[model samples]
Target chain A: MERVPILKIGDILLVSIQVDMSDQTAVQLQEDLAERIVATGCHGVIIDITALDIVDSFVGRMLSTIASISKVLDAETVVVGMRPAVAITLVELGLSLNGIRTALNVERGMELIAAHTDEREFAFDDEPDTETTASS
Target chain B: MERVPILKIGDILLVSIQVDMSDQTAVQLQEDLAERIVATGCHGVIIDITALDIVDSFVGRMLSTIASISKVLDAETVVVGMRPAVAITLVELGLSLNGIRTALNVERGMELIAAHTDEREFAFDDEPDTETTASS
Candidate 1:
């Protein structure tokens, strides 16, 4: 039972699925990723699936579930590096994986998360950074 | 100068781009759809692109633009029937079509819009329908 490695880069969690997924493995990964999100306090999760050539319904569902659950845990999820063949197969299987964000690769995924994080940070800075001690 | 056709089904507007899109067509479709959204006062929009084998940056941008504009017009948009190759190319081109809703086909697209429409309708219903509300 090999576990998918989740690397933490700043406030982001990077998950690269380099092996084929069994139904059980997909389920286990979902649970593990959720737990990791809670433990790491990561604000973003990027799943790199460049090596995967196929995405069955089970795996597609798992990806969608991971994304929605991560959001509930206060993190955004980006699925990256989905090959054309895999994407084609998934679409043909009638699984659009709706509501899940995606990117071309891990680099774009990181940029996407970083942009989101920056936006959130600015959300709390309604009072501009016009610093002037006390009564300047 | 060819224009994409938009048909109305109930309260949903259906636009199926059946031809290969030139950049101008993509731009024009966006404008036409935004105008139609305002005119029809529709609750939902479904875009069918199953006939397309490729999705370039311009087309991808149009899809996103249509979704956002529809949102601003109080209509929800769902892009349906994206071919696998198109999706794969989109991901590779770094166009994730962010913030756009998608479904596998026209049937599912309708269901997605219907679900959204129903939710909004029930939003004003203070009490839940325990009796199934006209079960007869």
Candidate 2:
């Protein structure tokens, strides 16, 4: 079975799905990601699907499952680089893949994750950032 | 103090901000929204910001805070009708409004919420929709 490669960039885990995903492969990727998130303590997971030419209901559910798993483990998942056709197909199929966050590209995915992490920190500490306060 | 009105449409709550939001007004809106969500048991919130011509970091944070509060109360928040210039200003201010979901208009926002609500029901029930399964 072919396995997806997960790359770690700083505190984010990046996974680019370049191959056609089988049921077994998708399950493997899910397991691998959960482990990677725990071992690396990464707060973000970016799934790049630019290379994927198509997606079906099964694939949509797989993405949603991975996202739910990551959320349970205290990590945010951002699906990026979805082709227009794939998006249209998903909508037509009635698989919204809800509870999943998406971005236009990996850069925006990182930005979203970074902003989320900042918000989490802001919630814990009542003090505003010195730079922002000074500017205001 | 100007109070934002939350209208209940179906199972969704809609809030359109047309007046200038002061600090106290923003806080009041937040409190009122939380109360409405609980009282009405609405599963979705649509915040229409189309009337506001400009937005600052404080408004950005208020939006974020409301989204977070809605999430905690088991409701989804979709911000709609944000203008282009407002989006640019938000980015310039370094306020990403990260966790809040956005849509182009009220219709799209409602669609997003509906899709999300469908996904939740799908999650709890393993059986796929009869229509979709039959068609597939």
What is every candidate's C-alpha DockQ against the true complex, given to 2 decimals? 0.01, 0.01
lDDT of each: 0.75, 0.81
DockQ-based class of model 1: incorrect
Q: For model 1, which pairs clash?
A: none
For the predicted complex of model 1, DockQ is 0.01
Judged by whole-model lDDT over C-alpha atoms, candidate 1 comes out at: 0.75
Q: Which stretches of candidate 2 lie above 4 Å from their native place?
A: A127-136, B1-136
Model 2, first chain, TM-score of 0.90
lDDT per residue for candidate 1 within B44-94, as digits (tens), equals: 898877556778877788788888888888888888877788888888888
Query: Can you give the lDDT of residue B101 in candidate 2?
Result: 92
Task: At residue A125, give the lDDT of candidate 2.
Answer: 75
RMSD of each: 19.2, 21.6
- iRMSD (1 decimal) for each model: 19.8, 21.1
TM-score of chain A of 1: 0.84
Task: Assess the local accuracy of residue A95 in candidate 2 as a C-alpha lDDT between 0 and 100.
Answer: 82
